[model samples]
Target: MAADPASLTDRRLLSDDLLATVRGRAAIHDRENSFFADDLADLAGSGYLGAMVPSPLGGAGLTLREAVHEQSRLAGAAPATALAVNMHHVWVGAARYLHERGDDTLDWLLTEAAAGEVFGFGYSEAGNDLVLLGSRTEARPDGAGGFTFHGRKIFTSNSPGWTRLGVMGLDSTTDPDDPRIVHAFITRDAGGFEILDDWDTLGMRASQSCTTVLDGAHAPAERVMRRIAPGPSLDPYVLGIFTSFEVLLASVYTGIADRALALAVETVGRRTSMKSGTTYSQDPDIRRRIASAALAMDGVWLQIDQVAGEIDSEPDGRADRGAGWFRATAGLKVRATETARYVVDEAIRCSGGSTYFNRSELGRLYRDVLAGIFHPSDDESAHALVAQSLLGPVEA
Candidate 1:
């Protein structure tokens, strides 16, 4: 018989071995701008795709905190692979959150994941700054009880491997004056969706986050999960996505910072200055910079740990929901991304000109860190959310 799918011991062993394998291939994947196909296959086979599902469902039964830590670990080996896999985790985490709250609406999601079905996030739009609050995609009810989506989605990670795509669209057929956004899951076998071959970019190239065009892509009635008014709703599903996505995204970047700092330490300890005949590790300025970066990273890691732990401990998932949780998660995203950018820059500065080469791991990290700025809850949005949380919303 196969090992129990919920075994944390087995999960860790598999992740460790997977990380080792992915780490060696990261540079090559980045250089070629190819997806981490092997990484995805191994993760799926190892039952990692269902890590957030409960043990009874054949998953690892990991809490959000545990899953985020695992993500950070995976990111240290291959940031793109970890980021891509995060989409699947987001869905599973959301399902677990809902299930714990007595809502079994997303139980099917867990079952599908347990059966090795991969899920991808499809909420991003090219110019939609009000993410989740609005959408350019059209969702028309089929009268037969289903819906069809028509529009394009960008930054669809796991595009090449996703068996299901979770998407949202505006449903205005009932009342255009008061349109509502509908969220649903559609399988890859469903016709009318196209994945464009245009994912080349500055960093995280292995993610293969291509653009997707949905021309009347249908989502059956059963898969239509939520329908809510747009613009900062306190719905549980919305909160679940916000909580999981922001935390996991932060974890990925934090892992990048950790790896960059480790590389800096290795370089400084190995390189000797000709004039001083001493390693850079002994240089006071270099030491100070590294110390500062370490301190910043420590702060980010602590915040992630605290927030995730709090959520897990709260049976109702209420301790970290609504405006306060949103503010905290947004702040974490901004801080973690900015900290990673700073750490990677410092690592490059301390390591010398060689780090500027395209093939340099540090260089890839530097570029990859920049992508964080484009993710939701960006610096401006985060600050705005924080300000609104402290003070009232902007006066009419």
Candidate 2:
């Protein structure tokens, strides 16, 4: 029998084996394996991947708080696999957000997504940073109430599994007399589009963050996700979407640190050094390192929990006084991600030369956790946004 998305969500929530499912077959996702082609089906079937879809669309209607806990658990099990799953959930939540806005385009995307379909984000342009306001992709009218997308989208996450691509570009052909249109479009399986699976990187190799080239992809009128409207602005669902993305991303880092700490503890328990008559665990230096990492990881978890609670309380995006909450969430994302990198590095140091061995799980975690800090949300730009919002708009 086919499992209903909503029913599956309930099962996942209530099951005592939820942690076991996330931490499944960890050895296969370790360093020597280096990929997780075998795990996606299990993940999809487990209802771990499609929880964001709404009830009307046959989804679980679970909130961002649920996603954070699940993502963090997955990260602790296998950071690489968790990172891939994180990308999928990010798009799923965003799709649900757009779908709830009562627009036809969003409605179609939401329906498809609810059927266990995947959408990839193509926001990172080539030779560009997080500042997408200066995006070069051009959308020109095709004169039949449709538009043509002619540009390249680089660093598209989960390229192979994408049933639809969410694109953001400027409508250059809009009448100059009117305001410049920054439009978000959703195109499904366009033939002209190509996913360049050339994402061979040092870390998170399983992510498949490939480059997608759009060679005049025809976006029909129904495909446009939404146009920026002049009004009070901000959608409650969009707030949920952003918060979900940030918290989940942070969870991945926290999980990485958790796993690394575990491996460090295990290694210390088993290995003994000639310099000392006892195991590494007995060494005060190693114990101190472990203690520091533990403290940092705990601090990060506290921030994530607090932020989730605050976001739930203030469902609306318009928390004028809640700018601090928003900024704090962003800062937490950056801090947790950065702290994970440090934790992994310290764990490696504590593990010594043996940490470099591919057999060591800590070695794999080190590579995976480092990638989190390089994501757009981990950098100064994200922090600056928080500061600007809390400190008032800065003069250019």
Candidate 3:
């Protein structure tokens, strides 16, 4: 016999009770516009923060695919919380991706994370649309084989709890002829960086992804991780970061769509139409809309799972793992985020006007889903990458 779902859930890091606790706290955090401190504490206590550490190191040692599934579950319980926590997972996953393929550059990161240090993604900037290809932040050599960063970063997730912040800047002084994009980590106690209290936004307030201001923030010689040319290349480190980020990011939004669909199904089951004198579940139009939403959601996981598996299997490199990796990752990110927006809209339409209230779960999801459009590989970029993959880049 198949094991009872409840028993299985009990064995997981995101156990049912844990999710309930997190779910119960999501609204409060959103309402107060505060960080999910309790949720983070609980997750850390459950060993979730160290889930990417190797099994021999006392971590769960989940594969990329397994971690994606767990992220979806966490997101279904709390989207903002899950989205913020995803930054930590992304770094750990990248380290694991590299380590499995004989790259020990980030082994210290893995070791530090397992020892209870949390990391945050601090790469986003206000106007650096180049995404990882370039940076507006300045990286000046400290002359001791180290570097000092000077600039501002937006959407600095896990700002409240990160012991280490991953950052990148352009090291123009290193070589006048060629400025390299330098990636490094700055510790919270290192000084020179401040978290601005400016995260208030349309939604996802619980994340407290405030703006981080770096004024001569220092990354010690050993802390400087990578220095690549100021444009796109299929470098292994670049591919590892892209794969981990895109797949995990997609999983979070997919979970939002999943939750919205479930809520819609529950709504239809109880809603009755005045003209039909029957539940919305019996209404063909309602059923059809709900089906469309479910179908869209159902289509996302397989692609996400497949891509994640490919990344896990061939961390030697995503590009080498398969052709059109940029296309695959960019396409999946756009697909999942857009699907989430579509499904949340449908769920609201079926759930009645009460869902329009701020107090409604669907309302929160609607606002949260909108944030998806702005993540890396936006709609236009994703389409461009997909087009370039098939038809080649637009002529100069």
lDDT (Cα atoms) of all candidates against the true structure? 0.87, 0.66, 0.86
Q: Roughly what TM-score does model 1 have, to 2 decimal places? A: 0.95
| Model 1: lowest-lDDT 10 consecutive positions | 1-10
Rank order by lDDT, top first? 1, 3, 2
Instruction: Write candidate 1's Cα lDDT for 133-169 as tens digits.
Output: 8999999999876799999999999899999999999
**Best model per lDDT:** 1
> Candidate 2: which stretches are off by over 4 Å?
1-35, 95-108, 130-132, 177-188, 229-241, 316-326, 390-396
Cα deviation of 61 in candidate 1 (Å)?
Answer: 0.5
User: Candidate 3 at residue 259, lDDT?
Assistant: 87
Residue clash pairs of candidate 3: none
Cα lDDT for residue 38, candidate 1:
91
- Among all windows of 10 consecutive residues in model 2, the one with the lowest summed lDDT is 1-10
Provide the global lDDT of candidate 2 against the true structure: 0.66
**Which scores better on lDDT, 1 or 3?**
1
lDDT of 2 by residue, 67-127 (tens): 6766766777766677767766776765654554443345555566667676666766866
TM-score of each: 0.95, 0.84, 0.95
